[model samples]
Target: MLRRSRCRWVFVCILLTVLLRLAPLKSDSDPTTQLIGDVDNTQSFGVNPISLILVQKLGYQSACNSCSHRDLGFTGRVAGKWYSVWADTLWAAPGVTDPELDTPGFHGMVRSSVSLLTDDPLRVVDLNLNDDWPVPHQQPFIPFNEDWGESSRTAFGGASLCEVDAGSATAAVFILVNAFEPDLVGAGVAKVQVINGTPTVTQRFGPKGYWWDATTTPHYGDKISYRDERSDYIYIWGGPPNRYTGWLEGGYIYLVRVKAADVFDLCKYEYWWGHQQGWKPEVLTTFTTETAALWGTGQGQIVWNDYYDCYILVHLGIAGVTLYMRTAKSLEGPWTPDLEIYSTTPIDGGLVYAGVAHPYLDPSGKSLVVSFTNNNRIEVVKVWFK
Candidate 1:
């Protein structure tokens, strides 16, 4: 069953990519920003209606020549320093998938880690499994565990992070856990601790007996609250239902909120069931419907922009391969139509996906810092809103 699902998903992705190439290009009237300069011989291509600028290019090359990392899981400020979590692997090249390397028990299995960002030359610090960092062969902050499943190993490539107070004496890091095997994908929430500037997973919240699978429940954390000012609760953007057919599909983004004091109480979370009629609290329901579609693959960033008095959402179109932005006055939003920010074209023989926004990195409230994953590198760009 797992093999079949994987095969079907690959076929669907290929067919969708081809269909997108054949579709007519979307027209945009919004004013955009152009690339300021080039990096690593790669220039930004396509129109960015959101005025995104290429500020700096962060390369992942480590002192150890073989391993590399991609997939920006999440970034947050911990103990007065900026840190990012990413999915890392030991593979030497792209497009080379060895089952031995892909399996859960593989020594070089994909794992998650937190890295400190430094300024002098724009490089990563304290990178796990890298010679440049002090920590070597340190256990993954969120490693594949026995409780997940016999064959299930987890890689949180698209995870989101937020700082929340669990009413504890120490600060806590809330992560949207994305777990998957070759056949299935699931999500949940995990509590992480910063021990001496390193992230250590301490607890998890989700369904009983099984990992947070989409086929079993409608509630799974996608993006956690980045800038909700409320001290009482933390908000999470939920993803689509995980289908057995291997394609997780949904057009509307959902909202889930849990009390900041009760971050670990999975049963206490409230879903936004409100509609056009009015707002109401429900146990587990979607925040939006099909009529108000927010297109994406459920991996993106959401930040509150005080300058605009609204929430900004950045995501990648699964079919179009374009990065887009939408704004809403409220968390349960009547979101504006997607304004094309940037689109991915074939670069260095690889495709791009998962364009996310880093509002904390943007010094000017009007400028936005965006990051996207290419086949070989993670590209970061800056955008200014008109």
Candidate 2:
């Protein structure tokens, strides 16, 4: 039954991608079709007009034909500039997928611009902006934690700035990284101290080199965070192996949170145990079959929108090819059903993932500048929710 169900989903996704590819690719207007049903009445997220504008690649075309790069995480402005951390980068000739070509990870900053939400094209310049910076390739943001028992492993496969301590003297930033070690593929947190505007690794917090919760079973945190004023806590999201696929990539996400001020301490971390059951002292991993998820999958981000007065979650859906959006009044419960927001086949001939929303780019929340990856190329879209 599981095999049959999976096959059916694969068929549906392929068919959807094929149909979407036929849509128009021109910018500054709606696509040939609005994949989310009619734009008139109920299906269009109510009567609001949604426009996807300036669908262009985020940076210059790679010098190599088939460079593969994906998974972008944004950092707080350090020394007057914003940074984007990427995972598994490669610069190679066309059709090159050799494992040896992997550069592991790297970071870059957006070129000097007054605003990221502008309609003009944007560029994600390499860290070469600073000549004295030790990292020429912007690699090795977090060294492999030997304490995690993965000493033989090299750099972290993925990294994201999950929390920023702006009030501190040196603006401490907490980064969540995926070890990606064969035997210990899980998540860990490291502290990055910004001194004189440059980010430097300080220390690592938590024992989650391979997070087991209390069960000690490995899980993957997409390393996405959102602060809730009602609880005054920043919720960190992780996903266990999918019930269907048995892969930790993205399915049935769970939450654990710590006070923004206490992110360095593991004792303060609390897990969600449903609305009625509330939160508990110990790390909560076990969940009843009846437990509900805020939304499905990872490889995305959650941003609070002031215009809609709700939190908008943009993620690469379970199908793996499509990008989806879901909205909720609060971070905890009662999220709307998956709404197909963008189709990659129409833009990049498919094979796209890591759909993230940049709320910092649009302070008004009326329009969102979203970034996603297609092989080595990173593309941004300006989505206006009218």
Report the number of the highest-lDDT candidate.
1
For candidate 1, write residues 211-283 as lDDT tens digits.
3556544434554345365346566665545431222234444566676556666667666554443333444
The TM-score, computed over Cα atoms with residue i paired to residue i, of candidate 1 is 0.68
Clashes of each: 4, 1
lDDT of each model, Cα atoms only? Answer: 0.51, 0.49
Pairs of residues clashing in candidate 2: 212-216
Q: Which digits, one per residue and each the tens of the lDDT, describe model 2 over residues 205-315?
A: 556443343224214345455545345566666554322233322245566677867766667777776565667777654433223244345566677788877777777
TM-score of each: 0.68, 0.66
User: How much is 378 displaced in model 1, in angstroms?
Assistant: 0.5
Task: List candidate 2 stretches off by more than 4 Å.
Answer: 1-70, 74-81, 91-121, 128-136, 146-148, 151-160, 169-182, 206-220, 228-231, 241-250, 346-350
Residue 133's lDDT within candidate 2 is 27
lDDT of 2 at 100: 35
Error of 2 at 229 (Å): 6.8
